[model samples]
Target: MTVASPLRFPDTASAPTMTKRGWWLVVMNILLPGSAQVLAGNRKLGRVGIVATLVLWLLAILTLLTYLIWPSTVYTLFTQTFSLLVVQILLVAYAALWVVLTLDTLRLVRLVKAAPNARAWIAAFSVVVLIGLTCTAGYASVVAGSARGALGDIFSSGPSQPPVDGHYNIMLLGGDAGPDREGLRPDSMSVVSIDAETGQAVTIGLPRDLNPVPFPTDSPLHSLYPDGYGYEDRCDVDVCQLNSIYTEVSLYKPELYPQAEKQHSDPGIESMRDALEGATGLKIQYYVLIDMQGFADLIDSLGGVDVTVSEKLPIGGDENLNGVIDWIEPGKQHLNGYYAQWYARSRHGTSDYDRMARQRQLQDAILKQVNPVNVVSKFQGIADAGTQVVKTDIPQSMLGYFVDLGMKTRKLPVKQLELVPPTIDPANPDYSQIHQLVQEALAPATPTPTSSK
Candidate 1:
């Protein structure tokens, strides 16, 4: 035994770094993945680690930014087509970073074990821990739960009343999402108007491809342009697409200008107003475009909403348009996001006018679900879950007023009018002429004042 002990030796090479500076560097790396090295004067190595962290961080930021600014077409892929998987992958990355930071902290404690100058490293780690705690507390206290709350009630202001007679008109459009499509086009265009004096709501939807809006006056657009009238603008009447009429409003009505110029068929609001007013005989006040994505998110927030099916929805498609088969069972049912979206966008059945009818029904459903009693109980939950999903002409401040208006609709009846080739029953349909009949259906009826005589 004595002879064997003579050959035994200490394996110092395998032990912790007991030197003062070595331990300090270890602590720095533990606290910040290399901050201790910089503190101990290893400038190059510390800088490299920091640069690596910055690059990874910047990459993460870029990923989030792309998700936001992407074209509506691409955004649909992320939200619907590839939604859950993309979210899972991002979450994994965040988790991995958290795990690495945790391991690094334990490694640093082990590396500087029993070192005399370990005190300095320990103090440094303590300071770093304090900073982290401070940041977490700040976010929890002020940033996370309290932003936008200071603005007062969330739905305090909204479409207080559905448009009544003598009010503005709003148009809403929804797009069907698919691998073949990227951007949003107004799928459900509704002209929601409210009377300035006696708030009333009136809504109507126009098919995306409905065009060739005819005008009473027949002249080239070039001649009508007061700003730059010339022969350049030449279209006999508004023989252009109905959607394009929004673009050509200035040409026809040189007196007015449209707001909110957007890239793809922004369809100037004024022309939309003109088209509706010309067709309906009611002066349009305003137009609102509610995208499909926003509609989906809002529906989802309600944790599924209740809607009544007025007719059997027949969903089928052909080469000319986006389509769907009948989805709902044709009675009152609770619908989730996917189902709600389909209910709103289903175009397969009989006519586009029918699809428009579904849109109004869904709107009614939403207003009913968020009534005062429901809003208080379900509003916050839905809002927290789906705030990112909605964009609307009604500002956040105005939402509460709508809540008030929605309560009124509980007693008020909803009216739907279909305007198209079949305004005349198909059996008696006259191909030769029914324009006046169709026009008469869409025109707002003159309200007669009661005479007590």
Candidate 2:
């Protein structure tokens, strides 16, 4: 009876045949990231993909807004909780997601022999997308790896140092360790104090000859010396010197700073930090030790800094030897690496105080020159140069925080103080006066109220 009813069945021959290649599906996936799934019987996944893509775009927009409108909030988050491991994991997950989406799209893209040209175009598009995705992933991985290596090489992992009075103090040391020198001797010493909230910064430059340096009460140096670093024993033959802290600890008194190995990874710098902290009356969280020899290369990588040469600064010279080969003419000059290093370190015809001021000016000029565009353009070269140029105890986990703080600080004018001559006697520095100066330097600037018309 059913056969007698004319065998009514769906017209299978009238239906359009789906070929192996669906070029349009691949194109759809490329455009919308989920449309291929929608057409290939994965509506739920397609919706998820769409939602995820939208969320990602929304997050990007929000991040940009945060950077522009609420930089403080962004800085806080970065300093408090940002981690490189988390960033790397997220990057890997994103790359994996892209790979999955590409594979799924390819699967949906069934080939049609009749539309060979269309298939070829789709294949080409897929190839291009794949290459782009792969290159992007590779680049991200390289950057992450470079950062990880740099951090590991430069910083030590230890308990996070708390800020003092809502300010994080970092001791920057420009070490001049030549072949004849006994050990690393920091010629230039400065304490960089950064306000935790506002990112306002102040640089307190301490002369190299600063003597009778006090030690923190908690430091073993305080216990051993009791009075000062070189009160009982001198560093340079018969005189106590501040620059001697690095060489003395690293070469002469390693046993005294055993904790430095575990905490800071550089006992010399760590000892210097402890002494500087006590002298400055600021809790130094970290130390950035720059090799003076490599300073030129670092500046060169930044395309040379444009500094206003106030006087005829000697170039290519050391403290003891008259290596003055040239003089940077008094004017606004674009100084390359060699000249910039000399500008920062040369004391040929200038006093230590003048050199210090020039060093600070050079620092400011370099900061102005090292903009984001220049940095991005020379990222690889800079990273390579940085490896040899500087060392620090700033942990990788806190790198992002500092980077954000630095960005915030770049907008603010850098305040400077030199502990030289009439300001404060280096040999007999008044501790009370030094502390007061630090307090005043860190004091918040009074806001000028708007004049009501």
Candidate 3:
């Protein structure tokens, strides 16, 4: 009875407890995030950490599944500014939380006195290293994942397209469609031949009005129109414009392209690539088709491209294409999306030859203006427009290689060649001469050797 009255607390201050936890707790934090916190008696923080990690993991899995099952939806999401912002915000928050949890784990370790001397220092170092590694790895993973989704969306899985003559020849098509017209038309076309080893490139522009188009032997059009794509036997009107290949083959003559039918993809681009190869004398490996109407958005995303306009250029057109909407003045001017598109497309008073030359000049301007910082800043906008405006046959597997190659190419001056007017008449193109021009354009740039003797 007397002992009970003493209100004895059994030596609570001197209670035997673990002075240190081994490096295992740091490892646990690395692997399972909040596990170390939970073990150190911070159940609330631990639970929150675990829950966040699980949610992120679930989201990653769901994103991968959606990309595989419904790629179009993924593409839409990737392109949307709001969606990209949300994703970027989530990633940043997640990274911050991960770093906070790691620091908290380190704090708990210190409070528990679980690591001593060198062990404590080692644990601290581990937390710092983990924080750095996690942040870097996390961001990289997000970028890579987004790129994968984008590549898949733009370039559908297709047959193996190997490089031809130590280079990948991609046809760049500027498609223009009008409500008044029966079908889509490629108003501008170019073949970008890139040297695989040196990343040297030549952009060879093919005049859209090129008539009496030739077709490759393996192409279905060749079998049907053995001599040329000219409508000599088929129609009274001259229905042999290179641009017509899209509408004629893609819409009217789908049954003719059995290979494209087998793949269940656009036969128009395939046929056009074949025609371009026959015209340029280069084996076209793939094609990237972009809607010309969407060119403004892309230009805006790039901030603006600078070009030296020698004279006034018109903008906009009417239902009957009767008058000009606006005019871009002369000299070196920074042109936005609207003006840049018009600069490339304006042909009311100007000849097709002038328009083609302007298009190539605009291309050169874009290549020069694009830089890494701006690219990152405008990535979301570009990505959004890219999905909607662009389509290609460049496979996902080769995206990294091409991205790297593009960077290298951008650093170097891009050689430009245009088959317009006096160079080679589009209305009556000399097939052999066009082929010869392509060969000469693609000829490797002579190396400026060292002078050390």
Candidate 4:
């Protein structure tokens, strides 16, 4: 008679036990999104997760290696443009992934408990393998990322430089015409200085037309759409328009655009700095850019800024271009981002000098609006949003330290000046006189007009 073999029977007493592999697989799947599927014998699902993980890791590696190498990637990820939105999406994805992994872990545990014998052993083996792989992946990532960097690495991992003590002056150059705008101007030039001991931050703005022609520099003429070509370099820099820097870098010199930004300059900041320092006799230490878009966003992010009209501001436009001639009388008023941008860029407000005054006032507005409370609260949001926009010589790692310093000893009142006709005769700018004035100005006394008549 065909009888069921005693040993082949489904005996509850002989319930199978889990092995290291099974647990390993469960842990692996739990760590990422779908790693466990591979251990569970789901070839297709395992492949997808494996591929995705590899890609994510690759990007993470690239992010690290060049952390201090360039600001383009970080800038694109952290600014007010469309990239900010993408950062937000990634953030959400990260959160969702976390939740999914937690749920998955619980499910895996349940499955492992119910399984017996070979299945349990398989699961355990998977878990162990996964753990090993995970550790290996993590070590590889850290080593690669450390070698490369993510963001903080940029600042934290740079060669040490000498201190700026003797009449140290720097410039902030804001360009308008990117690679797209051919004959754009550099209307935003702020001469900045600080005393290491006194801890002061000083700035003065200039009109784009004030110089009419900046000392020549490379042109930005193309867009290197790296988003399209993974390992491809197609961007070029044509110094046709300052605003067009992005297009030029994106198009012609995409390779050099990012590398040059960090190592040196093609649309040279050094050249710009030399010209500025040469004109004003101030030693240029650092240079940074607050692009047009970022300028507007930063202002808006602070919910606009507060400024008192120092004089009657005639807000009107040409016969056709349009003007706001409401004549804002001198008083305290809250300005929106767009309005602030216009005010900072406006030359028709009386004279070009008045626009400089507006720029300093706006800078004050920014300092006032941002406080420890605001900064801490908005840190993550800012990190996510600004990862794509702001480009500076400064790196990410050092920001927190400086931010802490700022919180401790903040700039209560920004030391500011608008280089005027009497002190700054643009027709024939007197560099030596301006330099001496700046040196003296940093010593506590208010700066007097040093313009060459």
TM-scores for all candidates?
0.46, 0.76, 0.70, 0.52
Worst 10 residues of 2 by lDDT: 3-12
Best model number under TM-score: 2
- Root-mean-square deviation per candidate: 15.9, 6.5, 10.3, 15.0
lDDT digits (tens) for residues 256-364 of candidate 4 = 4355555533344544453465445555656665566556666665567888877755455763437565555668878776667766766553665676667777766
Q: How many Å off is the CA of 237 in candidate 2?
A: 4.2
lDDT by residue (150-212, candidate 2, tens digit) is: 656666566567778899998989888789777678888999999987889999999888878
Q: Residue 148 of candidate 4: its Cα lDDT?
A: 30
Which of 2 and 4 is ahead in lDDT?
2
Task: Please estimate how well model 2 matches the true structure, expressed as its whole-model Cα lDDT.
Answer: 0.74
* Model 1 quality (TM-score): 0.46
Q: Please identify which of the two predictions, 3 or 4, would achieve the higher TM-score against the true structure.
A: 3
Residue-by-residue lDDT tens digits, candidate 3, 1-453: 443121111122321322224355567777787777666647788888888888988988998998677544665565444465577667777777788888786665443433234455646677687768776757644664565456566765555566788898888888887676767788889999999877898999887778778888988788777777774534123366887788787777777766664452477878788789788888877778878889889999889899999888767776455676778999999999899888888877788778888888987788877886887666667767777789877655455467666767888888988888788877678989888888888888689999998
Error of 2 at 198 (Å): 1.5
- Which residue segments of model 3 deviate by more than 4 Å? 1-148, 231-238, 261-265, 317-323, 447-453
lDDT of 1 by residue, 1-453 (tens): 442121122122533433333444444554455454344334465566556556657866876786466433333332231343444444444334434443443344444343545556655664566456444433333321332342222222323334544354544544333446433334545555443333445454445444333332322332343222112334334333444444345344534443334211233444455555444445443444455655666677567888877655544556354464445777888888777877776655446667677777888777656653553345445555444443334444334344344444455554454444445332232322334543443455689999898
In model 2, what are the clashing residue pairs, if there are any?
Answer: 20-110, 20-111, 21-110, 21-111, 22-110
